[model samples]
Target chain A: MPEPERDILGGYAGDLLSWVMGRASSGDVWVTIMSNLNIVAVASLADPACILLAEGVELDDGVRERAEVQGVNVLRSGKNVFRLCAEIASLI
Target chain B: MADSVNFHFDIDGDNFTSAGEASVMIKKLLRQMEFSPDVIRRVSVAMYEGEINMVIHANGGTADVNVFCDRIEIVLKDNGPGIADVRLAMQEGYSTAPDNIRSLGFGAGMGLPNMKRYTDDMRIESEVGRGTTIYMTVNV
Candidate 1:
């Protein structure tokens, strides 16, 4: 959690990496169900506030390790994408 | 060109996990050079998409980044397989990538368009059976 206090301005939920990359804004809490190494790549490129893995999706050891090494803050939630987005919308 | 700084990298197509290494490296270098955050993000994101295209479409390729005072230029060259129709490939939702790639969260056919979207200028040179070369420039 390099920027643990990084401000969260909005939320974006999508699984299509390219769509997320093109639309996700900086400081946005990006929600997705995709758990692959490419998620880290997109997160890095898009500079999202943090990656919130929805629907209980978990990162593999390799991806988790890479995410940590890349300084990408990732959080896992058992809630589905809609529910998580709702919670994020309420909070931010 | 005399004052420009050039960096080169080889893309490893066999490993999907390592695909964006070059873009990440260049992003770090640009940060060290203190380029504007917007410029850094645009350059890195554009290069990352190009790298993924090479890894997913072409077997792999070479990437060169030339940083000048006024702009940053990225040149990606791949020899695996060239794009048949440049126009079609540039479409937002058009993709020729197999199902496995989509499962990995890519192949949404957004690579080329995103590259063009983020960069100031882009040009594609491809020969169907030979290879593809993409040139992109982002103004500083």
Candidate 2:
């Protein structure tokens, strides 16, 4: 759980991976409960600074592997997506 | 690079979740080839949108990317239902996608326009009930 070295400027919240893919911006933190391989892909394609997995959802090995290989930073939270997003916004 | 390198991918239309795989792969290859971040992002977004379109409209398709020193070329071909009105289809907000597609955050009708916006050159050929082929190039 290394803190993301890349600085995040803002955040986006969505569960549908494609929706996140089309709108997430570079250097933005992505807020989602999606912990799938495509989430990793979408994060990579969107060039987001990091992906915050809300609600403490667990990522299976496949998704973990993809995130590691793709260099997508995944952070976890016990809070809901809305508050998590707001906190991320304050951090940047 | 001394010679052109080509990357080919099979876009599985049945799997909406896997649509961006090819674009992600190409992004890696482009980065390895030392393309700038801006060019890579443009090509990746344009190609991702095209790949998603293939899966959404066609059953599946083929994406071929050729990388050269000065530019990258992408050609996508599918045997799915051809667009009835290419002009209308290319409009930024006109989408023929069903309601289900919108729930997935796609079928926004921005695919073709986004493709054109990112690429330096674009040509689309289609025949009703036949198929469609899109050719696009991004300069380095």
Candidate 3:
């Protein structure tokens, strides 16, 4: 069988939350613009490989602290949500 | 494992941020038990949706989970104003939640549908003026 896709970026907090909870595999990356602390909770529940905050948004201090405790890899992009998604799509 | 385990939690309806706490804890329990990832995910999503519903519609509720060898059963009971139309409520895009709820990134009418989607078996018992009970099972 062919290998499962890796590093594919999925966007939208709600849809991404659903997909991460349901469809996303263990190593897939999630890209979204939502900066709330709940994003960390969703990541913990979904067990995504990593999370990318797009649209040049910075993580809240609480979110960053929790991410450190949870060991969730988080990255930020200077681009917009749409542009980041497109770039992630190209990688896949 | 030959023994069955039971877990119970009180969901706080007033706090949206804490809605999914029970589900999150249950996920950890299942993982510690070495349940399959797929099974764990299904249970997590189903229970999370139920928890969210209880917080959003009902003024919170009680969640009971029974973990068996072959299946995991989740029961959510709420005393909130019961669902008027189970059929309409079951629809994918139908929502009675207010605008305030939508601002919180929920109220998209996907809660019930998502709960059903993630479970192997689901049953909803509701009385218009009384309350509602949701029973969902995910096979291990």
For A24-89, candidate 1 gives per-residue lDDT tens digits of 988899999998888888888888999999989868899888888888889999999999998889
Q: Please compute and give the TM-score of the first chain of candidate 1 against the native first chain.
A: 0.95
Which stretches in model 1 have alpha-carbon errors above 4 Å?
none
True contacts kept of 3: 0.16
Instruction: Tell me which of candidates 1 and 3 scores higher on lDDT.
Output: 1
How high is the DockQ of candidate 3?
A: 0.33
lDDT of 2 by residue, B10-58 (tens): 9999998777889999998888888898899889988988898898899
Estimated TM-score for each candidate: 0.97, 0.82, 0.87
Q: What is the lDDT of residue B34 in candidate 2?
A: 87
- Between 1 and 2, whose DockQ is larger? 1
Q: After superposition, how far is residue A40 of candidate 3 from its true place, in Å?
A: 2.3
Ordered from best to worst DockQ, the candidate numbers read: 1, 2, 3
Q: CA shift at A18, candidate 3, in angstroms?
A: 4.7
Q: Judged by TM-score, which candidate is best?
A: 1
Interface RMSD of 3: 2.6
Which is the leading candidate under DockQ?
A: 1
| Candidate 3 local lDDT, B21-135, one digit each (tens) | 7988898899999999989988988898888788888999999999999999999999999999999999977888888776655677777888898899999999987999999
- Arrange candidates by lDDT, highest first: which order? 1, 2, 3
Q: Clashing residue pairs in candidate 1, if any?
A: none
lDDT, each prediction: 0.91, 0.84, 0.78
